[model samples]
Target: MRRPVESAQYTSGQYARFARDHGVRLSVGRKGQCWDNAVAESFFATIKTELLDRQSWPTKALAHKAIFEYVEGWYNTRRRHSSLGYLSPAAYEATQETATERAVA
Candidate 1:
């Protein structure tokens, strides 16, 4: 027999509260709208391919540490993201700052 799981992780109440607190609009994806989640899926796929798939974790603590290092140390600061014009997230942010300053001056 197959076990059934909750379809959504967040409840309407929780989502409504979050949206109210954050001042952002939130909407549930309509059925069969897979493209709505494509970017998030792509990010996770990259993370798994670049970091998680390579490591063998013996414990939850080890896995958490590895994930933290990959996300904070390597992925955020060092890895070049093609979506961000082949720059790391940090570098892209820095370039944006320079461009903003140039625009102001």
Candidate 2:
């Protein structure tokens, strides 16, 4: 049996049609479950504190470009993550790749 949609945002005809066309599931966490979305909230809070709160953009396009650059150039590449033993994401991924290759050899 198909599950009932819990949120109106996902229940609208337009969203249903879009999801069907894209072969996507409109899934969300249970209502009042803050833990399910904690990672996303933390990421947004970091962005707000580091970028959004620091600058004023005159255009939406500029803001979009700035956010893209910030994520790609700094956050994903150079910024150290304590969760990854203080290595940047790119460095952590490289280390993982090297380990995998060594194990396979």
Candidate 3:
């Protein structure tokens, strides 16, 4: 017997096939699970608050450039995060790398 495919299921299946074919890993989360992407959600909120809310961008390219600089130059390198005990992402990564090296030695 042939079962009917719902539109949402069919769309998701097609996307999953596309992702698999392209070697892209898609994040899986339950329909109502908020915490599954809590980190990403928090990051988005922070970026919106720290960058996007402060100014108006005339073009997408300008916005993209600004966001790139903010993330690479400011956020990762200089901004202190509360979750990481006030260490910048670069500093936290350095500490983590050091710990890994110590563990391997």
Candidate 4:
């Protein structure tokens, strides 16, 4: 399950009960600020649009495997991000690694 993002509504007492019941930690953004969760929200939106919305799975295991493959195989290695100058995340990381090595040398 995803982490809870709403504030105030989920007090410490509520979070404790939720955590105990679900065995998952609940996280909240700082008071009145919503940007803290934007990155995760954006990621889920992307995955839903590109992966989840396009397919159906007969089983949970199949769905999990498909998600794993979509993230590692396509999203990390092939999908381009405008923020990264249209480079795939793996490409951006490789370029960063190369720059670091050159600086070290």
Backbone atom clashes (below 3 Å) for every candidate: 0, 0, 0, 0
lDDT of 3 by residue, 1-105 (tens): 996663665237788899899998877665556776786788899999999989999999999999999999999999998879999999999999999999999
TM-score, predicted candidate 2 vs. hidden true structure: 0.66
Q: Is candidate 2 or candidate 4 better by TM-score?
A: 2
Q: Compose the digit string of candidate 4's lDDT tens values, residues 5-66.
A: 65565555677687779887666655667776875787799999988889787899998999
Off by over 4 Å in 2: 1-21, 25-36
TM value for model 3: 0.75
The list of candidate 1 runs beyond 4 A from truth reads: 1-24, 27-36
Clashing pairs in 4: none
Listed in order, each prediction's TM-score against the native is 0.63, 0.66, 0.75, 0.65
- True-vs-predicted CA distance for residue 7, candidate 3, Å: 6.9
- Please list the C-alpha lDDT of all candidates, in the order they appear: 0.81, 0.84, 0.86, 0.84
For this target, which candidate reaches the highest TM-score against the unseen true structure?
3
